[model samples]
Target chain A: MVPINEMKSKCRFAIILGVTLAIGNFFRVPYAFSEPIVFIANDSVPMDSITRKELKDIYTGKTKLWGNGDKIVLTFLKQTDVYAYFLRNYVNKTPTQFVNYWRNMVFMGKATFIPKSIKEEDKLMEYISSTKGAIGYISSNKLIKGIKVIAVK
Target chain B: MKKNRMIINVVFSILFIYSAEVDAYSSDTVINGFITQGYMKTDENNFLTDTEEGSFEFNEMGIKFSSAISNNLSIGIQFFARDIGDLGNDDITVDWAFADYLFYNWAGIRIGKIKIPHGFYNESRDNGIARTFIFLPQSVYSDPWRDSLLTIKGAGFYGYLYGLSYQLQIGIMDAQTDGGLAKKFNDITKSSIESIQPETAIIFSLQSTDLIDGLKIGGSVSKWDWKMDLTIQDMPAKSDDEALLWAISIEYAKNAFLFSAEYSIFDVETPIDLYVSPTAAPYRLPYATNNVMEGYYGSISYRMTDWFEIGVYHSIFYSNKKDRSGKDNVKYYNWKDYYSWSKDTCLTFRFDLNQNWIFKLEGHYNDGFYNGYITDNIDKDGNEDVEQYWYLFAAKLMYAF
Candidate 1:
């Protein structure tokens, strides 16, 4: 049984080391994030970058007040794909099309509910350092220190 | 009994209008809502209404509401309580009542009873993670054409720039037909009638999420115009009857390899027929004529881990009843005979038992004509082949505020 071309060269080096360890464990089973990808806000929220789709439609309550009458509050994550690819690349959609257009703006009652998706970026930076007209996005390596990082288009 | 005491006084006036805005002092009057209940089982030849053996239904309640009314306006309402025959009794309905205006985060506008943005499940087709199967895709989004009850009274426009999103809509109301079976096949057409005219509609959608990286795609189109009493000589009869719809949907999940799908089509241009067994002696039977209908469906899902994943779906429908006048001469026009054609099928299976539960199993096979009348067969050729088969099971539970 021995030399059959050295067992076909050890089965072609074990099929190229099992396809290079199954593509190196299919992308090394970790999508970065040991923290630092924050965008807390409320440092007197003067946003820009197409106002990040009006700050993700005022923290997902679909922009209720805030041409300076403040009143938007949101902090989400808890279902990562890098938090739906940074709000589908800051509101251009697709994280299931911005969760199917906010589940059709929350079943057509036009707004309310949909933002408070968590998964400990230190408990969403301790509720965005004790909430207050809060806005969110974290994991540029969990950027702690009293969050604030706006600027996305 | 007074419509179940006016649906228990409109569900205690929507729970005393959200507990009087949470006992006032809630500044910026904001109150949210979401509650859905489900459980359904049906087997006996299932294809909408094909009763044969397995039967179980729950789907007890549904709700949606939003309030703000200034600071750029807002107001909304949605309600449902279907499936009343299992002591899980219900039939309440409201469906939608809207109003919205923004003008910032990329423009906004919405007006009463709206939705009818036809396809891609008519605007989130009553959420549940926007679709993971527990029903929908019945040859293109369930419960017939008036998806999410088409709402309408008109007005819509929503925008989002950069990542791309655009929607435009137009409306006009009062239009009904689809499984509420209407019948009457000549003797010069008559047998309980109604058309409630003035129905107009339009919808458009466009979407993109910055070119792939966990994709999202969109496509939508809709058309509706009805006004008819039945016309053919010189044509201008006006109960015009029209329908044209389109759809494309996609969703991709990252890291765990999840996927989603949707495809749709429906075209109708005036078709209706009704007649059944006119008394065995050349009975002049089976009539419920409607020509030109179309359908399509496709679905794919994969998760394979993270609380198990599996999915499959397929659908098809095309019964626009045509007789383009090549007269197959069914015995000297057996009362102006006209049969339709199209293949029909449905298949589905899904299970997700985590993050708030879900489970579904589906199977269906249809060959056409159930309520649009054909009385199980007569006349040997109005496209006789009303075959059917069905089985369904569903379960759902979700909670989050």
Candidate 2:
């Protein structure tokens, strides 16, 4: 048996905590998105399209090698909306949680996947075009040269 | 304080390397580390250190080097040093070193000094700046046992099956002779600990992350064995210990709010075949009984702003499951009943000064001494009395890359 005392104190603390959680959950916190995210990859990628589960796995540092045994390189946009949209839709994690996941993996010595952060759309396109097996997300639906906008099923 | 200077140089090296972008995990071989200086004090009673008087003996610094050798193989290592009151004393040691091989998304193996999965955050417990609290709840993540329980030397298997992720490890204990836990063991035996060596260990971890969005439920079970080398009257004696531990954890994160809870138990027996060997004669410590210890806590934290966060938790622990009253110690050792349990209510305020700097303050209302690793009733001044309740205050400043 545990020896935690003071029943009344526990009740009061629990009430206050419950109320705080309710308020925090009631109001929608920022850093959310409804914008569509387009997936872009290099020509060296094995598959022309990807699935939600597959993308989630790749982003979380679970699947490092592609189906054809090529290393999967990941990239992320510096913008908040596109990053939040992509993560929420498939990865089921906030940006903070996503970063922590990778950090934890690094701390665990996995060193498997550390996504390159790109600041702009043109630079992201140029990098993906030049870098083989690289995949990234952009908010723009317009097609760019030297990059394949892989369909997300 | 020369170690502080060395850590400063190391910190600036990280700063110089990633000046343009504060992303330490940018390159192929990620180089990152953190430096922290902390202050600890208590209204009464000493905690880990001379907390009755404010002390800045709390400091930790570590650096990690990690890289992938191939698409499916990687290796990494971290070097760490710390000082908390009279413990650690800035001893530099290898925190963890491992070579990992990935067969598939559902299967990977780690060989070398693999992590021990106790609770949800046990493997990552030493990453202070990466976490929100200066100290995790004492209910399960006891501070004295931090280094001793961090990792084991052996191999580990981890992967995701269907929606369940699992980590299985088979190894030996990484017992340190002069680490924090060894000091506590000294308190337990009232004798000097010469060394603690590994014997046997096995752990299994399982979690379900797909059952709910932003929610996770996990459990871990482990069996651990170790031998302690002690000196009594200049004669060396060896004692053996066997323990079984298990933990259940639940966490949910939504938006900026996070909630977590865990319950754990440790069933321990010393001298597994007690009194059967002549080597155990005249060296056996009293009260080395088969006992079950339990701990649990519920915590909540919210990121109110980009720069600020707040968290609170109520943690509880018991030294013995069958006798929560702890009366036996009084009958045999003339000790207080409260020595067998600990209850703590903690609050913390964290401020992220910048991407690379962090500051935080914390306060705890403590009700017992068992979880504090306080076995002796005497203070540093040899006072034989103790307080039933006390307040502990702590603050920390950290720089990380």
RMSD in order of candidates: 20.8, 3.4
Expressed as tens digits, the lDDT of each residue in B350-384 for candidate 2 is 87787667898998888878755464347668755
Tens digit of lDDT per residue, candidate 1, span B1-401?
Answer: 35854775577567656655563213244444344455544443232322333334434345665666555677767765455232224555566777777766568888877766555556555555545565665556545343223556788888666566777878875443211222312212333334436477887788765255557677887776665443223222223456676777776656544455666655655444322233432222233323444556555544433333344455544443244231432333342322232222333344445443445454433333321233323335645333333334555554312
In terms of lDDT, the poorest run of 10 residues in model 1 chain B is B178-187
Indicate which candidate wins on lDDT: 2
Docking class of 1: incorrect
- Output the lDDT of residue A10, model 2: 77
> What DockQ do the predictions score, one after another?
0.09, 0.37
Can you tell me the DockQ of model 2? 0.37
